[model samples]
Target: MAAEAARQAFRGRFLHCLPEGGGGYRVEYLEDGVLVVEGARIAALAAAGAAELQGLDLASCIDLGGDLVVPGFVDTHVHAPQLDVMGSHGEQLLEWLERYTFPAEARFADEAFARVAMADFLDALLCQGTTSAMVYATSHHHATDALFAAAEARRLCLIAGKVLMDRNAPEALRDSAVGGIAESRELIERWHGRGRLAYAVTPRFSITSSPAQLAGAGQLLRDHPGVYLQTHLAENPQEVAAVRELFPEAAHYLDTYDAHGLCTERSVFAHCLHLEAAEIRRLAETGAAVAFCPSSNLFLGSGLFNWQAFAAAEVPVTIASDVGAGTDLSMLGTLVDAYKVCQLGGHALPPLEAFYAITLGNARALGLEARIGTLAPGSDADFLRLNPRDVPLLAGRVAACRDIAEEWFAYQILGDDRLVRETWVAGECRKRDGRLAVGN
Candidate 1:
């Protein structure tokens, strides 16, 4: 039976950064929350001017008391099983993936371990106001299944897949190309687009995956054009060297994936920090996106990514925490670190640009612009209510702000999980400090 629809609204002074204003917005005293059903995919958005909301009796209402209701964040790249491995230092890409990542991911063979870690990871994202993400699962198929089940129950938009690695990884964590492809196909049919769930065609990286595995991943991409492709790319010098060694016939680091059919509009390569000009052009040509993991880059001491180059080439870029290497789950902290990265590289990213990168911009890159990432009607009603005065430093900063843009900059510089007071997914108030803020 179809779910019964319900009307709901949140009345308060709300603020969300407009893409046109470049990370600023005009505050409005109004009501705008999600109109949903027990299982409706966001019936509509209710605000003063909408015709559909006219004279309709709301089922339940939440008074936000003038908190921000911007679109929820979209984290383009993260690892579900890497929750416990965050904050480890030194070792660059390949070595680190082997020394820390692979062994740790190997543990996900235990379904219980993956479940506990996934629960913590999802809760952290909710608390930090990230409603959607492209997450990575380890080689174990059950690990990916567990993540999908968790996201489905929570009604969060989560895309993930089992890592495709047939070589250069621990024996237990590796899978033959044939087995990997079969497992991925089965999972995609079962979970893709089930509620807010989607599947990604995840190859760990060119270094860890053999030619057969890369070929298999490419075939998967060709077979399922709607699913996303995610993997590491040009993240570190050593990893680049390894790619060259593995694919000596290929032109460059990006060429390995391109040689296979994996270079397409749905592909998202994390950390293109070290790339030649030609590679950027190829990325633009393929219409692929890059996930700029600033905190991870800094933490791993990977070289800085050239945003100017990305901009000049008109290549799409998304922001991600790249957790385990990235220090915090807060996109605000990642944005601040991104700003520092820009300053260090002799360029400055306007606070608005950084904000867009994590929100709407990221949505565009991930092919989710139509349904999420903005305040427009008909989009999924996922958002966060932020208290600019959530901290003493932020309180002072908010007091001095001349405009909303400056206030956003202040949050980018100082905001953390504490700044988020409420989180909503599809109009359901899923979390609030210690209580279930909204109920069905």
Candidate 2:
């Protein structure tokens, strides 16, 4: 059934975030809370039994027994077309594309196949507690449209773009400079700012897109302001070398994009693992966001992202699954990997900060924090019901928790899709039992 944007009330142990004095968050943990949802927006949040709610009708209330409701995860970097090629092993960046990635994407040329694949990908994302994402579709315009149409029907907050690769790639996946730019422009006109959807100007990366095509993409961004830019950079040593070989006139790998005005506040650079001090500072200075795919990085044997350096540079960073290459879809799993990634370097990821990274921080990175990130009033009602008691080890861990902070800490480290009891979007419960909670 399609979820109606109707008013409802939820009583649970709720977690929400507000900006603290600095860039950190002030977490509000309501032990016994009541959150009122009127249509797609959060109307009010208060402790249960508050007299202010006494006058409201209580029959519409839904009680989540001892489960925790937190904002849904926002994945800033994902490949909607590469769902079936995730675990193909033993190849670096360029070779992986030739061996596994490109071949899988070639199949998107069949529009029917694209539809089925995108539907399952969206379903997987919801089951994994990802309500909002910035995705990359294939080079086929119709294939990308299929992904957008799927997201539109579900009212998902998604930002996606068709891959623009004019030079390198198999004959089936390549589009000419003029043809690719025209297709992108048409897509932007058709889909940009449509409902909860936005369009990104995607150039697969320097390796696939020629200088002419990259320049064309930059022109598209200028022609339509606020359209996002998504692409890869410095993800692998060989990939970086390829970019240097391809764009020898540029000072660095980032300079390849900078020369064409692709670097902007709205741009999302995925897996910036081997960035230099100058690149880090430039990313901060330009207000461009970084999509940190720790799980994908580890799985591909790419270098570790220096999180502290990015943080110290005051750059905006968001966590993502980068799936098909990424091991799994769970944000908790991503956080667990992020924690391990940092721990290996003798650093710590505080659980509160980690939670904030997946939710509010990610929303902020996409410039959509005002719309989908928090349970704050007037924000969209997208969240997940986490049952810490659902898993055996998690149940025991929760039983020993000394406080709410400890409870969250245990959940972040131990939780995954198995811990997600339900997923809600726009005041409607959508997923349970690793599938749709409500059916048409």
Candidate 3:
């Protein structure tokens, strides 16, 4: 038997979500308990039955008393330095970036600022039950290091990198093609696959990166085959027009990245609100996943994302809290906005579908399905124990619900950080009794 199992404990009441198509998920009940320790992966449900706790001095048992236990949320896109600038009023994407995002990012040159902002970002994620994130750091390389360092100490699965841009922004945030490529390659070699960490080759967007810079970023992607590639595509009308002027040779917005080899199976493109049919087909063909930032889209008055387009193209979509422009760090808020976006587009993002998108759907998009995103045996036991009674609205909604599915809907639509009773990352609880406490 594994050493962690030697001193196993009760897992508490967990409602594990199993994916079912058409906005539906099946909840698995683990009333018996679950166990973990010694840096081991999550165990099988039946493993709880094999070990007896009476004979061994073991790790402390945490009884959740039938709280919901689902996989920790995986956010595909967020700008770490812009955490404080989230609610800045902006009319559109391009103006928002110029007026707010650029100035905010330039501050990351201060390591102290980066450290404090990163601390808040990570703690905010933990409070909301988000243990993994594919984040964007500023043009400052040290900022990226600060983010990875914080995540490493917490044992969280985090993917992040320095933002590469040569044009269309502040001089302080710009990097030449050669310089950016060198820095990105070095970062990938140093951090990729180190612990639960992955490195992302991030270009702000086609509008911000020159051809030379995009080419270098594409080359970096080739060199670091397993590292993720993240960028923006078709977010706002003016942004799309800017891409047209910048890359006149490319057929469309997605083609710019496709030509540079940045569009690939593991690449994640955010805010595909304006993708045309051909662009959608190419995205599907390239096996790229869309990081739908609904709140940001709405906040900036960018076009609404058509989930039906992704569905028709048969491309998987993941939800993200694209913070800074996105008002909240809560995945639940993102889902609620997703529901609104879908409804405005004459469709529905049901509760099960929203839960799955935040969990399994997101993990699969990041190619991290095997490591997390489910309660199956051998996956990491990173998840949250949520008290539906924690929030007054949630309590009222749950009181009216008839089953776990309806109760989950209440949490998804009405819940926020307050609903998160405790968060467990790699089987170590990080938050308990409404206080921040690291697990041993």
Candidate 4:
């Protein structure tokens, strides 16, 4: 990759979704804006050709014409290895795991396969304008190591961990509780806090992990502060029932992880579709974040999540592809599914709110909003330059837009990876015109 200049500026139609005092997003769209980047941070933003950048070299300026520049999407949850079996269907959660998901993830035990998959995954992430993601890998430590190396090479802000599954999994895919914790510790030692890369202590879920391993995972968090804890939660009814059968002593599915001290601000629990009122209240009280996987839930025939109830309960929520089960990597696609999910729940998710959930909202869920999820001054220079008129349909839609609100809603309903004209990460342009940028 070509070295990024010490400082640079880009001129574009800028957009950032700041939180409103109530429950929605406050959208700021600048028809003509200059975004200044110094090192890896967003230095400043001013009107195009403003006095602030008067003496800067013109060679350092990236002009996006009429394209839209917004903060890069933050996918709070995705399975990096599961991208291989993304389109497979016809089974619910448990049956799906046995038939397709586990088999596909087991392939990551091969080092070469893991590297290739992670490389492609990161490329897919960048091409679609995802700059930061909290990802999951297979049980193999070396394979997880390979994923970290691929992400570090790309300078992507990634948080990932090796899956810890001790029982009820295929023998080839399982590891003992003691061994799994040891493997996770080794990985955390090597990769945690390295550049923009962070680590998550991932105990696959209660069905696959033993109590000993869960406690070990909790201890791992206490041992290492600021590291994250990620795992699946009440994604499906059968999964929740299995958790009940397994942990008969616990109060509910959420209690399985909460019993392990795994419910905190640093914890990310994916898919609480089966939660009751008490569980939602507990999530709000415990400060844990839920990764609402709308697409995956729809594909698996999991129950519709009550978005309004979660919001009313004040439980922190972020969006995810839950890829493989989710069927797509596009955050726009996730937003699309989210919109439909909310519609089914009789709650209308405005386009502005949907965009916020994927960008700043997700960042806030991870406690990283100050560093990312915005074009706010001093944040990372990670964002996407999108042509709202990239395709014929979008072009027509853009032409008909009465205002920015209409344009935003139309894009969420119609956009995909093709809408991403360029993806910029940490002051460097990584993808342009739906492909890797020249240097990348």
Candidate 5:
């Protein structure tokens, strides 16, 4: 009886996504849902009045009545260290890196500062209802280690790696090609597959990493079978031109990385705003994914992403905050920018599709669809409870909504952190009533 009593459950209006034919998804909503959690995974998700709830301890279930429950957001491309630089005066991608990003990252050499910043960064993500993320730490190996430590302590399903840059960066932040790969290997040995954490071999992008470092990064991926590769690609026209000049022999920007064996099934490229048609086909062929960072792209004055073109090419596309460069950390807020970006390209993003991108779509891009993205049985119980009526204006607008789709669109356009009433991670309450429940 005691063991059975220990199981956790929640009753609410649940929403999630299910794959349909033709690589599209359909929304599934249970108006009066009962989500039963055992240990760290969901045991059952059914109607409140379903037979599955007959003998369960509903008396102690967390009743989130009148609120919307959905899977927590998964951010595919964000810089954990760039939290300090977010909302700074926006500059072009290259100048922004030199002006704001590099200087801020230089501070991470001190492990103490890195620990504190990483703690705050993770807490901020939870506050914004982000549960899982692929993060980039500074080149300081100890700082990267601190990020992994903080994430492990919180039991987050996080994927991160230290930046690898041997040239084209500030002197203090650069690491030798040999040294960078060795440190990444050590970090991988120490942290990969530990609890819910994974490692990504992150080369800061072709502009920053030399040929040797990029090749070494690819080698690390081969050596560590399940490890991931994350980096930027074709974000700005200037950056693209520079890559062309630097890699004269390569076919294109994507070819530079592909030549080094960096394009793989687990690789995730961010801000592919200027990818050629050939590059798009190659991304699909290699099973690589793209992180459509709309907020960052718009903020940096980068060209608009052709969302329709990517979809037509069958390339896996996921939404990301891309903070510092990206203006907001809330995936809902990010979707607002994404909607506008798509609109600029003559295709509006549907509300359900926007929600799916931040949740299951992002998860599938990271190869984590079976775990953190859904409320399906046996998946990790990482989810959010959102209150559309958190503010007076939002309440008024949401009240006029005709259906769940309209309400969701209203939330996406008008919502911020306040919409997130609670953020639960692996069945543990991390944020309650829009505040951090755990000590920082």
Candidate 6:
């Protein structure tokens, strides 16, 4: 890597997604481009030999030979405290949570353990080329604070909040309705809009949080505008049935959250695999986003996500790695699973569309498109240098590709963390040569 400087440039093949008319996206690719970074923002992006490159410090530019430079991935939903339990024996959603999720989250009550776990979690995310994510922390306020502090130290764009679960969970992992709301309020005041950190009022789910707790979470969102709301929705049939039994008066599972003013533009619901038509329309009406966590859904035997329905409704959708329940942390691997899930539902996912969903689409869902998720000038300088030929199988497959889209598809199908050569966050190299370069 070149020496760090206030003004620096990197030359590579660059690609980014642009929103098209009619709620679609188009890919913009530059064969030989120079990305100029000044401070923490992108100053300029131009062809290597274009006149715009004149007067620039071309001699100091670091050239990434034949590598692909694209915006870093933005994971819409992930759990920071579940790193230790990833790939645990797959069971249904409720059973898995009780068996594996709760115990793993219980350890976060220890501040020291939480700090170390949060560090490892962030390192894992950076290694997988994820620069921005909406993360879920355990119910412990101190642990949530530790996560925010670590992310602030690294200057990462991370959104997280303490879990709010007043019932249907072990005592060690539950918080009272009033207490949870108070802690969340404090976290939002301290972390929201603090540098690159933000807070999300997280309710574990309808099954875990009492009615009062859910209402309190909504009040928290009302009290603090721009803070995010994240929770589980209709992921499993059993879970859906449970929600129906829990809230008999509500029209549907989504209605429970909606009644409490939790269905705002900033809210993100994960694993909405079994939503009804009315629910879909309501999501569209409220501008709430859904996180399509394919890996977790598949691993937990949850129903398939109705991508076609959501797309038709024009409700925002973003891909996510719901880690722990999810099989891996790499978004590339997650995309592989996403493609398979879509295919299983007879809707094929295009390569460019998959890439777009992880980058600009996700940022747009989170309402952070202006700050991150693109190579557009003035956006944060967060990106990845990916080498499709990182492994022999991937290299051979890419070598036979006739176009950029084919090459990208091959990478998604065969690539993993090894494909990421470098990850840059805020113009600083956090991972280089497939290893973490920054201290966690």
| Better candidate by lDDT, 4 or 5 | 5
Clash tally for model 1: 0
The segments of candidate 4 whose C-alpha lies over 4 angstroms from its true place after superposition are 1-4, 19-25, 49-60, 438-440
Question: 18, model 3: CA deviation in Å?
Answer: 4.6
Residue-level lDDT tens digits of model 6 in 69-188: 999999989999998888787579889989999999999888899999998899899999999999999999999998998898777999999999999999999899999999999999
Instruction: Give the lDDT of residue 100 in candidate 5.
Output: 97
Compare candidates 1 and 4 on TM-score and give the better one.
Answer: 4
Error of 2 at 294 (Å): 0.6
Would you estimate the TM-scores of all the predictions? Answer: 0.90, 0.96, 0.92, 0.96, 0.97, 0.97
Rank order (by TM-score, best first): 6, 5, 2, 4, 3, 1
Winner by TM-score: 6
Q: What digit string (tens of lDDT, one per residue) describes model 1 on residues 1-440? A: 12222455555444443334432333322344433323334454446345335764544545666566677889988887777778776687777887888878888888898887777778888878899999998889988888888888778889899889888888999899899999999999999978888889999898778888889888888787789899999999988888888889999999998989888989999999888888999999998999989999998889897888887787888899888888888888889888998898888888767777788889878878767777665677787778776688898988898866687889889998878877878767677774545332
Give the per-residue lDDT of model 3 (tens digit) for 1-440: 23433334555655566656664446565655554443446655432344444332224555556676778888999888887787876457777888888888888889898887777778878888889899998888778888888888788999999899888788999988888878888888888899999999999998878888998888888877898999899998888988999889889999999999998888999999888899999888989999999988889998799998898897879899999899889999888898998999999777777877888889888878778778777788787778877798778888898876677788888998888887878767788767777622
Model 4 scores a C-alpha lDDT of: 0.87
User: In model 3, where is the ten-residue run with the lowest total lDDT?
Assistant: 50-59
Clashing pairs in 2: 1-439, 1-440, 86-324, 430-437
Quantify all predictions' global Cα lDDT against the true fold: 0.80, 0.87, 0.82, 0.87, 0.91, 0.90
Q: TM-score of the candidate numbered 5?
A: 0.97
Residue by residue across 244-276, what tens digits does model 2's lDDT show? 888889889999998899999999999999877
Full-model lDDT, candidate 1 = 0.80
Q: Write the residue-wise lDDT of candidate 4 on 262-288 in tens digits.
A: 998888999888887788888999888
By summed lDDT, which 10 consecutive residues of candidate 1 come out lowest? Answer: 22-31
| Residues 338-390, model 5: lDDT tens digits | 99999999998989889899999999888788897889898998989999778
Candidate 3 vs candidate 6: the lDDT winner is 6
